[model samples]
Target: MAVTGGLIYRGIWKSSKRFGPFPKLAVAGILGFAVGKASYVGTCRNKFQQLGLEGGPGSGPWSRRGPSGRGHRSCHHVFEDCKKKDQVAPAGEA
Candidate 1:
């Protein structure tokens, strides 16, 4: 992103000559990184919410972790849990 921004500033933006290219390049790189990180976090949050695994503290994915913090279940496990919760027996059945 910094490289691209530098190229654009040097090659196109004639008005940017006063402040030079470094500032624009730096701004572009920082903005790009921040936007990318935010996008990734948002995507994960949406996916977890959709899977009903983001209810927070005692119910969110983090709740499944072990004392060593290495027992986290994969998405498959969460999906299976969802399926089980959604299954229903007939009215006459228990």
Candidate 2:
């Protein structure tokens, strides 16, 4: 879904194809991706929260590394000991 949204955004904002620069398109791609992802994520999260669930984070997902020594995991990710797993990423690599 984000990829589709990104394509739409890229067409609208990058139609100019930048002017007289080698890196202009690269810059545009970077900016377009940031804008598109932020907008898409914000919209989806807002819509989900609007459903009126209790105490949901703004991302509709929690972060790992809770204040407690016990780790936390959002629906989007699994819990793992980051300190111990620094040598290798958690399985299913996002």
Candidate 3:
């Protein structure tokens, strides 16, 4: 990530003279991605707390399940929701 950021910064700096609005766009894209990742991590933490597994031994927001054994179930539900939407999309559209 640092490498990519460095490369982007270098490119922007090297072309600042001719790239008028492009530098702003590139910087915005990088910042947007950083913000999005941070937001997703926050959401995951909230989900962990809601599931009652905020800080279990091996079950964290990034864990597959809680130490109480509900980690997989929560992960499963997230994917299942997406699958359910996809399955219902055709009927809804028609």
On TM-score, the candidate that comes out on top is 1
- Model 3 lDDT at residue 23: 65
lDDT for each of the candidates? 0.58, 0.52, 0.59
**lDDT (tens digit, per residue) of candidate 2 on 1-94:** 3453465466643433545332445666688889989878767766756775422453334445442223454334544565456447556432
How would you encode candidate 1's per-residue C-alpha lDDT over 1-94 as one tens digit per residue?
6566656756764336677666667777889999999889867777767765544235534466532233445443445654464465344321
Q: Residue 80 CA error for candidate 2 (Å)?
A: 32
What candidate 3 gets wrong by more than 4 Å, as runs, is 1-15, 56-94
Superposition error at 89 for model 1 (Å): 17
Model 3 per-residue lDDT tens digits across residues 1-94: 4544565667743435676546666776888899999879867777777766555345554566532343344433446765676677766341
Say which prediction, candidate 1 or candidate 2, comes out ahead on lDDT: 1
Query: In model 1, what is the error at residue 84, expressed in angstroms?
Result: 22
Off by over 4 Å in 1: 6-10, 15-19, 46-94
Rank list by TM-score: 1, 3, 2
| Model 2 whole-model lDDT (C-alpha atoms) | 0.52
Best by lDDT: 3
Q: Using lDDT, rank the candidates from best to worst.
A: 3, 1, 2
Instruction: Tell how far residue 58 is off in model 3, in angstroms.
Output: 7.2
